[model samples]
Target: MENATTLQLDPEANSNQTIDSQEKILTGDRATGSLHLGHFVGSLQQRVQLQYRYAQTILVADMQGLTDNGHNPQKISANILNVVADYLAVGIDPLKTTICLQSAIPALAELTMYYANLVSIARLERNPTVKNEIKSKSFGRSIPAGFLTYPISQAADITAFKATLVPVGEDQLPMLEQTNEIVRRLNHIAQQDILVECKPLLSKVSRLPSVDGKSKMSKSMGNTIMLSASEKEISKAIKAMYTDSSHLRVSDKGQVEGNVVFTYLDAFHQDQDYVANLKEQYTAGGLGDGSIKKILDECLQELLKPIRQSREKFIADPSQLIAILKEGTERSNDESNDVLAQVKKAFGLNLF
Candidate 1:
């Protein structure tokens, strides 16, 4: 695998910046739908590793989900437990990682409202992430105000935890900028620094392509194989996965680049010798798409089988699952309360 570009942070620019020796990390998924393999390879696996090293907090971002799914609030509620199950299934330890719901934390909402006033409408419009999402969702004229200003809410999520490290993909780089911008502005206005600036922890295996070789693998695109997909579902998705269209016959040369099967293998398969030999054969000819897809299917099933079993165990005990989230929500609220109080004091709103 090739090395990815490194992310840089500006520590000297803000003399008020302070970092805890044990760096705290805050990351999460939107409860808009069940997570898929893209989530696994991209962030879930990395979160599991970061738990042992940092004070980790995972959020089921239902409030953020409501930004786009405002008309369908039921969808967000329905998937909350599913997202929790997926997190535990993928080895996110409850003891080591705090798993909380965004809406359950009142401080987050309060912080967002305060931070929203710090950022201007023109600056929000210039945010690359917001612009890109607006275009992607085709919300041209009717873009939701919440969706446009999600970056501010996101800043609250990070700072409320005092998180110093945030795991993000390349596309989300601008979000970190927006967050730090708010922090800087607040510190400058109040004549005291209240919020801590965060740095981006770029994922090694960034974005995964859709099974149909589309730009990204997303549930909305109908191109994803869910993390909890059954053997039959996995088989169906693999059969439909896109391959080199120019490779007419088994004997014809094929292009490995942009091929979804090989992409999956690169991300999931561990055997270097086997993958190298297969790639050679695939490029030279004789190997077929069916054979490649079969290998990918088997690899995915093997990877997900244990995750599926773990998810089922948690799902079977719904009360225990809810209890876990409630516990985390309580812990997270306690942590954020201090930050919110400080913000209020800075703005002279703590007079009461």
Candidate 2:
């Protein structure tokens, strides 16, 4: 068995590495809402590039979406297909990358039930990601147990496929850390490597800030540009984006440090030199926020045009989307059930 250590992969350097066709990657999104530009920059784009090189599976985690929204179960159910559409729109080929619905996979829930025993409430509370989420959600004394233990659920999602690589953002590193802890503990109890430890394939791009610039781009906050955003919506979002508050006029010097427009340009604009030149002009007191916003608007409009069209086409044919999910979920069921059997045997629960 390999040493239990986390290996980080720089997405920029991924092309230079030798292709490992056998490597299995498991990455996905919560089925709470449609994906956005932040999703593209953070992980969806990487998934598109990786599917051709590795055996990848994207899990639409509806069960995880229920952690906090359990009171509103309809929200999760309504968006499962929307999330899958966004994945397809963003170029994650369903044939190359298996796209599975989480609720459909019974083994995952079974695995989560078993793995929950390996993790403790104190350790779950101490997790940095969970801590931040709890504070931000203001759950107060009403924290949901499912919400707190979703990391263990996440571990089940990863290990059931024996996924060796998981694409994640920096904020999610703690979740992976806790996953490895569970993997190691279970293996230790089994006295062998029945479950394989996974590594984090961190995104090279930083998390995109919300248009309001007060927080990270999030769907629940209504501060993000969705993948299926129309051209008019894109332009409107760029116009309202937070930029230098002090630059009241075109001739006034602008600060680019916290400007959301420049940040989007840096992430989306293909020409870095052009963005740098624009930044220089803005800081030197000549460029206007409108001019730069126009540039960003144009860039995003072109970028999202095809994605919007693709998403719309998929949405028009619900049967196709259902077929894709059904096929992928069936495949996932077989694989995850095999892993659950091994885990059950490890726990001496395979009495039958």
Best by TM-score: 2
lDDT of 1: 0.87
Backbone-clash count (model 1) = 0
Q: Candidate 1's residue-wise lDDT over 5-105, tens digit each?
A: 34343223232334245678999998999999989888888777777666789999999999999999999999999999999999998998999999999
Listed per candidate, the RMSD to the true structure in angstroms reads 5.5, 2.8
| Each prediction's TM-score versus the true structure | 0.93, 0.94
Tell me how many clashing residue pairs each candidate has: 0, 0
lDDT of each: 0.87, 0.89
Query: Where in model 1 is the C-alpha error above 4 Å?
Result: 1-20
Single out the weakest 10-residue window by summed lDDT for candidate 2: 1-10
Q: Write the per-residue lDDT of candidate 2 for residues 170-277, one digit (tens) a residue.
A: 788888888889899989988999898888776667778999999868777778899988888888888889999999999999999999999999999989999999
